[model samples]
Target: MHFEQQTPLNAFLNILFDRYQEKVPAVKKVTDALVAQGVVKSQQDIVNDHIAFRTLGVPHLGIQSFEKIFLHHGYQKRDYYYFEGKKLNAYWYAPPSDQYPRIFMSELMVSDLSEQAQKIIHRYTDPIQADPVNGLNFNDGLQIGEFFHRSLWPLPSKHDYELLLAESEYAAWVIYNRYYLNHYTISVHALKEGYNHIEQFDAFVEGLGIRLNTSGGKIKVSGDGLLKQSSTVAEMQEATFADGETMSIAGSYVEFAERLPLPEYADMPANQLTPAHRRNGFETNNADKIFESTYTGQTKA
Candidate 1:
């Protein structure tokens, strides 16, 4: 939501919310308690609604080389999800307007794991022989926002990230967070009304003591309940590994959608509705429990 327009899609979404709010401290402890509880007026009046990534199906990378930087800035590629007990594989694009923010992106079926987890994910994506976004320079929007924080390989040994977090905590988070930005959504029916639904924004994010990803309930919905999600459980962050040692792992989180409206636009006129009468895309059982907002069973429940 910080787009001051260096435009290559606002410098790839302002360098992915400035390095995902610096490794996600519940994203500025919930955007500074939603700008000190007035809940709107900063963090660009919050309304992102989508921004996820976590790939590594191996060979040059996943989700077909990380959705060619938002399908080369015009997005589009919708639907198609598949979790199947988290072997994972997903999609959902549709941006190119509505001032951008809709992209999901997932992957990690590195041949459905276990051959010692595809030989420890081809031992760090087998030295990525090619397609690091085809060696970038994709019309430089600050070099595609620093090619999503570069470092495309090597650096995974905390016993190979707890042996790929015991076989797939989404492949030990894309083999040590390569491509990082793994969550950022917050479009609670465009707020401004008692925090606009998601059970009143999960009771204003559990009255700011935060920590909500209760796996399948602290709100999820969407079986025609018109999309209502919740998240915020992945914020551990210390990590050094590559044998140097350091620990606190999990790292990113902060989602809270709502969407609604579309029961044939219910009664429209929520200011004559926009974002096309709401309830759009995403909901593979509410994103397979919002990908366990960075697992370890919701970051240790």
Candidate 2:
């Protein structure tokens, strides 16, 4: 039997330390809370304190973009839906796999209308209750509360609903999908030895063959407004692999993008077309690099 050990002096290690530097207050607060509850002993007990991680939530626009991108690819679309009064949408995608870990795309509307959506963004921006046991303070904040482009996964579970709900109605809807995906764990580990690790671990139904969603698929622009497309586990038509082969592998059909074009719903209520960034309590554009949206929504965790 063989086991892989940690990579030495890797990018993950640097990220871990950077995360530590950035989220000290939150870490300390959490640790202190744990210590107070007698779950932890001291601040030193916070092992691998340098590691940073994130939990991303899916947006409505991302879901639409994903549908278009995937259809452009080759994966077959299993199902799709649009919710009324709740600028939310979802779709299921799968490929040829003995174990299909279905990919779900969800879009949350958070613009001029819903106050619930606004409140969720606020909680994400502002984390309350600090922990002093680990000397943790609520500082060196995480922009997660801020609105921008990101892909998150292993959404909040039933138990996490209250916490997520307390944050935003949109989050509540986003996290509810966790039950369908077995509430997997997504940890961004900046390894102590080195190497940045973004792992998505979860159990998919055996023989159900699921594929990772990508953006190489062709686009089918709607004559009117909505775009219609499909995806397959087969190779992308114009896709070329670095190894000099067609880009049609098992998980080849995916949805990814540097940005999501805002939808124009002139016929629909103006409140329905509100952009998520507007409701997201955080700044619109913070990073120099444009964050790409993925069909795998919020795997950034």
Candidate 3:
């Protein structure tokens, strides 16, 4: 979050966003459009609500291993969320300080999946006898940053990729894009008054021709009505399979979140309100649909 100084944490987060932004065209497209609209002067002017990553729930590689990088950087693990239908588990981590974006990490529940699906996942992951994070020099930020993009296992064959896709699209995604950032959010509430609400923000994004994930309506609202979110359908990339065959597959995307003031803080003026005054954590139902931003239904819609 604080990149002015080259601290290990800063280097790590900076590179993550740099690499992610470079690969996901939507990230720059959204930011450029916002700037043109007078939403903010530059990318740094926009507050990041949170960032998310997807993992495979296999030995030596699920949330337990993936979270060490952030946890070591002073993030405190927070609420847990389970997606029964998706066969996954997730948790959101609070940053050391509000200046940093919260983390939402999810893992595909390999065991809960069909036997064939589990077999497909393990075929690659089983070779990782030890958790890779333990071997890294956590003191070096660039090393840790590189670890996120490093391959833990060889790419799965195209047949295996489709086999897993048939069962869990998440599994197929993780197999190829391991440890890559799934998405980063722009805090819509932090923008100017007219652009500080979900409806207006979504409309503006739509006007720019950015396709939104429509799984749970173009905008997903929490039951408490304090957290409203929407995301662009993922960018599709042409991927060459291990077998030399290629296909356009889903990559990362961009998300916009508007966290309204909590009931007790509803009377507080905008100038006085801080992140503390808004909804704090993610909602399971909202996330359930947000996960589909990279899904076939949303991408193909």
Candidate 4:
């Protein structure tokens, strides 16, 4: 598959962001709040550190298949991460250029779950025996954008969802929200004046009436303390299950990240630094808590 480089990258990303904002109202709110606070001129001025996705590890899917789309677009797969407690395998992809946002994709290890959970997952995913991304026309920006929001499987019944929820909240989320944008992080350090740090941005968000994920603390910092992160709690949406039963469940959320300058760059002049001067890649400990943004306990109350 070949990615069409003729299409302006910013235009493609805008389409994805627009569609994502339509589904996740919190994104618009947070961005609007930032603009209202005079932190930036508009959403266009805000830099996206990355966008994340969640998937199920089964034939025809998971990182193996899901990654091909970005890979075709010149993204290079970077670090590999595992969430033992969450039964997840993930990786981050570096963009071909600085103008594009980084991509973080994670897949749930279906076999790692209990038999009942695995059976429930396979009951929905087993029918698709071929990789679905293979059918897409990567050259079409609209088609690529639609693929990200498309439903890959039948919606789960409330009963099955709760059963999986009892085991893995991440599994339950992917079951209903296939290929949905999980969250897009703002590069807090990219902001100017009052909003350049996550701590300041978190307070700014709370002032706008947004609740944060406090599972491991409001801010999850890396061991070296150069990378700090925070996110708003996932929003609850009414979902219609396969049985036509409706229930409120967590949808998507927004994340804020601050990658501080490396120790060596601490003494350098501001004009002398480059993107490489900041901490790169993600931290497992920070991500472990960020993943809790979608848990029922965190989103429900």
Candidate 5:
């Protein structure tokens, strides 16, 4: 399910509420007034405690681009999570203190390829049919997007790992026409050993016939605030497509956010009745005390 236009960040929460009116009646009253239209059908399990929605596979223009778009619609970035366990990215959004249920986006993954795979990618390069609207090539028989994330996660063994890595370049060529940007990042563990540093990332992307667009910083950033100035000779590669689209992605990195505890106290408040009620018609706090005390050979204290 894809939204035709950019979803206003403010109204997204209301949209979520309306989708579950029967279960969460508290929201229908508020969501009814908002005229924000729906572009996709409610296509997930709607239950008492949770809801899920399918996301459109469109690349955001940039981080600042999303911030400006969402902020205007009354949404502030509440929290974000990068699930290293799943190799996925996610974020949470609050509805400006005016909406209910809030909104969350997750299961984000990125990809990069190996040199042997780059040769295979050259065979499927078709820049002419790439749809600028979605930044994807409008071609059939490619069946490539299915394979993009296949290699993103680490495989069972290094042999299988290299096998998937070898195929990613061709997969990119087919999927590249359908999506404007490809997400690339080395694992946190990999970076610790000075492996596949960002400079190498720049050169590797160019080899697949794309240009590194570093201005957005969407593809490259050190999770730590380390600044390094280097004149070390950097390897160069080219990322040009058949239709003259050239880009080399560099410096965009992802960091997972820490988790926090739930507000259990707010959900269940404390009782305030004091000892003064003991003398009146107040009952004991024990449910069994009033039942069969004689049969059990026990007396209330």
Candidate 6:
């Protein structure tokens, strides 16, 4: 269901989360486990730190085009991040108000890829001569939700996918999953007693049989130690390719983040703190590893 004109921001976000949960089994599984452990009374009590999206650096799309939806909904561009190893550029947007989650959008530098990889990507995207976002009904929440789940290009052949995977797993993921929700992070610090930190929550999740992404260690902490993050390895789903072949591939997963209160606010009572009182932006070092949640090496059974 889409959000109506009078829908509050919290209600609109609830709709998005419901849609995401329906498509991403990992989200529900994790949420259910948290509830069972008494970390949260229900899924609604789990504060979302942020949600991320992956896009291509093609002509019509990219962060430039995709960000309009959130911008129209009151988000403002904030910090810019660069991932040299992955050839990616990203930005984290601040929500209009504290009640909303932050946004992280990343785009692949297709030109940075090898010629063979670029050609394969262009084969599907080259057809669209104009920016697709121009046609979106930004005021219609339902339309925007569908846009997030819609496929912008045809499926790639398994061979082409493998080629892209060899060079950049990020490229392979965006090419096939196009516009799919990458992951939604739970604000672990906001949880009830015993599970308010990443260490505690990570162990609790693992106890429920969830495998986490361990590329840069299971828990990626910021240099300042104010932001800690962890994510489950993506669950595999069968994806049908252009060649009529189907294979199990990694889909979306869930993430947990514990944004510590700044040193100045460490002694303040919880009621005195606000969104700004905590670590408010993302950490590149931590995010770089979080992106590997969908890599074949990490997702393969």
Q: Pick the candidate with the highest lDDT.
A: 3
Give per-residue lDDT, candidate 4, residue 120: 95
Q: How high is each candidate's TM-score?
A: 0.33, 0.24, 0.98, 0.95, 0.26, 0.94
Kindly provide the TM-score of model 6 when superposed on the true structure, using C-alpha atoms. 0.94
Q: How well does candidate 6 score on lDDT at residue 33? A: 84
Could you give candidate 2's per-residue lDDT for residues 1-301 as a string of tens digits?
Answer: 0012332222222333333323223233333554565544764333221110112222322444334433432435665545544344455554233111224444554554356555544444234133211231212122211111132232223434454444444455333322111111111121111111211110110112333222332222233312222121211123233234432111112211111123433355433433231111111121001011112232221
Q: All candidates' lDDT scores?
A: 0.83, 0.29, 0.91, 0.87, 0.26, 0.85
In the predicted model 3, the residue pairs found to clash are: none
Off by over 4 Å in 5: 1-68, 112-301
How much lDDT does candidate 1 score?
0.83
Candidate 1 error regions (>4 Å): 1-48, 52-69, 76-100, 103-129, 134-152, 156-175, 190-193, 197-203, 208-234, 237-240, 244-246, 256-271, 276-301
The parts of candidate 4 lying over 4 Å away from their true place are 1-12
Stretches of candidate 2 off by over 4 Å are: 1-61, 65-74, 85-87, 115-168, 172-301
lDDT of 3 by residue, 141-252 (tens): 9998899899899988889999988899999999999999899999999999899999998898888888999998989999999999999999999999889989989999
lDDT of 1 at 23: 71
Model 6 misses residue 205 by how many Å? 0.2
Model 5, total clashes: 23
Over the stretch 1-301, how does candidate 6's per-residue lDDT look in tens digits? 1223444444446566776677778787887887777767777677888999998999998999989888988999999999999999999999887666899999999999899999999998999888888898777666666766676778899989888888999988888888877889999888777888899989988988889999899999999999999999988888898898888888888999999999999998976777789988999999999999988768863
Candidate 4: 10-residue stretch with minimal lDDT = 1-10
Q: What's each prediction's clash count?
A: 0, 48, 0, 0, 23, 0
Which numbered prediction scores highest in TM-score against the true structure? Answer: 3
lDDT tens readout by residue for model 4, 189-280 = 88886788888989988988999999899999999999999999998889999999999998889999998899989988755666689899
Model 5: per-residue Cα lDDT over 1-301, one tens digit each: 1122333431333332333333322223212311122311231211111112212222332232223333454655555554443233445445444222233333323333345443333323222233222432223112222322222211123333234333432133223322211111112112212222445433433444433232223132222322111111111223444445554311111111111112332233223222121111101111011111111121111
Instruction: List clashing residue pairs in candidate 6.
Output: none
